[model samples]
Target: MQDAPRTVTFGPKRFCFGRRTYVMGVLNVTRDSFSDGGRYLAFDRAVARAEEMVEEGADIIDVGAESARLEAEKLDPAAELERLLPVIEWIARHLEVAISVDTYKSVVAEAVLQAGAHIINDISGLHEDPEMAGVVARHGAGLVVMHLQGSARQPARQPRYDDVVAEVTAYLQASIQTARQAGVAPDRIMVDPGIGVGKLTEHNLALLRELPRLKALGHPILVGHSRTSVIGNLVDAPIGDRLEGTLGATAALVALGVDVVRVHDVRANVRAARVADAILRGWTPPWPWAFDAVTGEQRRPLRSLRELARQD
Candidate 1:
């Protein structure tokens, strides 16, 4: 795996990686997102949810107009713009957080970037729409190129991979090359493994277990596994009850040095990332904790060392 990037510029904001993991809150404005569908379909609710996420510690807001579920119906560019433009405009005008629109259509990406969005999270890895790469390049927006075995609009097919990690790495490498050829800068690109999109449970597990291999691509890795079927399969819990499972996954990703995690439960995931970052990334209390700068040990203890030894 390549050394962590020093910094990445997403539109007007700059994010320094290797300090701590960043959380991206998911805001699906569609009525069929498989998890939070219809929850933010209303304009007021969607805007409010974005505000809440920002206050809850989300470094980015990922807005999706169309659902990516295999069984979900397709949404035309016009209809998608109708649902997306207003929200993107509102977030751009009101919110201070970075805005990322989840759409594979060039028309939609163009419109959203014009509407003040900073990033485009394309599930097709710039392969779905012929004009997507150029649009992203023109806007100079941050791009996330995700790997999907089958088309996002196509019906679910059995995913076949002899070596999931090697194949995914190669697929993403090709995507990065495509972006660079289209004039998109390397620092503006991030890669996703497309967990639960076209992969079976075992495939998803393998990707997660071998995520370190993705870092070798020399791009920050972004994983969106919140409340996914993989979590449900592991914990045997329903969508609403997967909070603990999602946090568990977040901690693991933090340990693996993931740069960004796109999640539905922003507050819980942010808190989990904090603890994991503290343990794995050498983070300590910010202030008022009387910690040793060189040793990272607390100078003042709640219980005296003598008392602790007596208990032992």
Candidate 2:
């Protein structure tokens, strides 16, 4: 089958895939993010975490003021602004990487975009407020349209699939059209498969495996399975111990050509992506590594080239 169309032609940044995996580090400024709750609630702590991610080679930083886990309540507009405004400014002033604000509220989206955020990573996909489309369009910011099952309260009921993959592709396609109709440009959009919100375990796995299928919708895909119970179940590990599983999934996702990885352990995922990217970077080495038949030994490496030649 033909692969889906792809473009990262958003404003100020063009996200071409296969050059390398783009790592989006998680920075939850709230006290209730399901996985890393309370860890970075303090402003200084959050900023420190963002700095750490940057040092660890994060390509983007995603700041969220509310946890979308379960019936997680939405942050009131004023509090949301109070929490993220300085964080956005701090990152903009200090880090050279892109910043994606994770909010579905129009108010929060507008405020952060004004405060120097480059993208609006909405989990609701413009379903929550019609005005969100306008805010994004006005600022000319990039958006992530995720396939959520439902709001945290309403929640997606079950796998109502006449083929979940096809349905999701259609939904995202229509969403892109909807945003465009409402004035958001096509190039400024990205689609996400909405991993855990309402998908069954099997449904989530299927979406992860077939993420490329969603490409037919014609936008970049951001796969976020980091520290989610999805990885936990895959390895039969608990939340705190799923680091290996998370990195493993990230490895597979990059190999499959997914565009961006939203992750918790930014440094580790960066390593997995770097290795996977070396193989997928479109040029083969003159020869494969030699293998010994006596003990099936592989002569891999004791040394490697570490940095890219500086780009002018």
Candidate 3:
């Protein structure tokens, strides 16, 4: 792990990590995503959902054209471009948030960056497409180099790590070196531990427990644990009922100093993150009137205490 710049600029947006945790809303435009697959396949529906997430306080809209499910079929570059171009163009034209194209194919990544996306979230960590790193570097897009143990086309094999944290840390360190070699600025890079991609429940838990260890790499850490099987297995709850579990885990991650959280339920997770961020980084009232009582006048509780101290 090497020290890198703490801030990254994407288009007009700059993400200054360590100040607060940024929430990235998931916008899957695929028909077979593990969760919420067909919900936003239509252009109108996808645009509307993106708008809803922006309103719900999403700092980035992660647009995925194909599912990353273990058993899912791989999408051709042309097919992926067709599914993602419209949504990415629309979001870029209509929204004020950063746009992250969740892809690993260099062609797909190049197309999306040309269509106005600001980030390329490569789950393969620059290993899948030989040209992925160059595409991101040429476009100067923010890159998310995630650590996955197996190829994306195949089902994830059960991970066999003697020490999950150490191995993951080493993988990311090497991946970061790869990205830097390909001309990606260190500040433009973020790393994901690939929580449920190739790990068992215990491995996932261990990664979460020692997430801060990855900070040694000096790139911002992005965790996407939303409604993963890790939580489902623990609570014996299905995907639909995992909201509380997701919030619980997100709150813990924020306290642990994670830089970004990718989630499905944007509104609920945004509120949970804000509260947790307030606890980890002290809260500042959004407005002075937030302290005002029901009366028309501003309450002066502290002033009253000062008067009492004078009498004493």
Candidate 4:
């Protein structure tokens, strides 16, 4: 485990690791997203969805114009900017939600940010673009840097790691160097371990289990395991049925003191986080959930949503 990073503020939200779990709701502005495809493809619908995520207790809204799922091609800068900027503008003008533009292209970032988005949730870190770090720095925007082990097109398979923890920690340290050297304030950057984008299941699990190891990098850790295939494989379920796995993963991260979780099922995750936060903060249980949601029967371990949402 590593020392926690300094507390940082993103717009009006302030987070210090070990305090509370921050939820980042996914608002895919695309027609082919793997999880919520076409759910928010229209600008008005996307804006409304962003508003609802805020109402659902999401602390941040992650807007993505391209689907980075398997074989998810990168969106060209112009089209991607065209798809995201309007929604960002509407969110910024209407809601107090802190919007995160999910793109690796500096061009798209520049345009959407100019429209008032507050953060850059780039999956490739700064490895994908020459000017991304500078753009973040110039705007003093928040940054989410992730570690990827392969090309843009392939999942990270059999990624070589003499020491996965040490290697990832060092890479993040170096990326922080790149960020600060490019004028990005050291306090404004957050790090994600690239949960599923390029990592295999073992790699993803290792990163999650050893997430405390990442705090040594001196930045908040962002865990995005919600509805990912890694959870599906673990529970033998499809994308829609991995809520329990998602809840378990978020609980584990909260136990490890991770700062944020990027998720799709915000309501369930909000419930789970409430319970986990109570346990971590030494608070009382919210509900005595010794039974199931629909039926009043004693459930098995980790079965009740309210039980899952209350202190153990």
RMSD of each: 7.0, 4.8, 7.1, 5.8
- Report the Cα lDDT for residue 170, model 2: 76
On residues 1-312, what C-alpha lDDT tens digit does candidate 1 reach at each position?
A: 225447876654468777778889999999888898899999999999998887777888999998888767689999999999999999999876889999999999999999999999999898788799899999989999999887868725888899988988898999999999999988889999999888889999999999988988988899999999999999999988999999999999999889899999998898799789888888654434457879998898554322321221
Residue ranges of candidate 2 with Cα displaced over 4 Å:
1-14, 152-154, 157-159, 283-312
Score each candidate by Cα lDDT. Answer: 0.87, 0.78, 0.85, 0.80
Report model 3's TM-score to 2 decimal places: 0.90
Worst 10 residues of 1 by lDDT: 303-312
Model 4 poorest 10 in a row by lDDT:
303-312
Q: Tens digit of lDDT per residue, candidate 4, span 1-312?
A: 323346766765565555677789999989888887888999888877887777677778899999876656667799888888888888888876678988888988888888998899877778778899999999899999888777544545566766776777777777788899999987788998888776667777788788877877778889889888799999999987999999999888877888789999887787788788787765454545567879877874544332332232
Best by lDDT: 1
Per candidate, the number of residue pairs that clash is 0, 0, 0, 1
TM-score of each: 0.90, 0.86, 0.90, 0.86
Q: In model 2, what is the error at residue 186, expressed in angstroms?
A: 2.0
Global lDDT of model 2: 0.78
Candidate 1 lDDT: 0.87
